[model samples]
Target: MTRKKYSKEFKLDAIALVLEQGYSRSEAARSLDINANMLGRWIKEHQAQDDQAFRGNGKLTEEQAEIRKLKEQVRRLEMEKEILKKATVFFAKETK
Candidate 1:
């Protein structure tokens, strides 16, 4: 069977049925014709992302993208700093 893809809005509405409408996960899943575990996973993803939930493939939420960029920058800076420190030590020994 081909895997089904759910739209972000559909996932959000399903989550709301459980969260805002106070339906149990199983009930919501049954009503939506989805697995209870799938509904639960959707709820977890929705809670983790809030408005950013269910961004499509190859996309990162703004906060997550910024964090990844910052981490890369930090790693680059740290490597540069390490190289400079080694260069300084090498020069000092050469000057001795």
Candidate 2:
């Protein structure tokens, strides 16, 4: 079965039920029809990351975005380096 995807707002609301509304994790999860363990994990993440919590698909934290950009740049540079190396070898052979 495909896993269900929860929106960031839905996760925040679920966390609010436990943190702000004083609902037990099990109670909140049952009322929302989600897994209790999942609710507990959400609460932990909300407490830990606060504003950064529940970054949905295709959303990255600033640091993560930077890292992704750097990785792409490195890949492009590596490809360029390989092309330059092949060109150098070709020129060296022609000069021999």
lDDT of each: 0.91, 0.94
Candidate achieving the largest lDDT: 2
lDDT of 1 by residue, 58-96 (tens): 788787799999999999999999999999999999999
lDDT score for residue 41 of model 2: 94
- Model 1 segments beyond 4 Å from truth? 63-96
TM-score of 1: 0.61
Clash totals for all models, in order? 0, 0
Error of 2 at 14 (Å): 1.1
Cα lDDT, model 1, residue 19: 94
Q: 32, model 1: CA deviation in Å?
A: 0.7
* Backbone clashes, candidate 1: 0
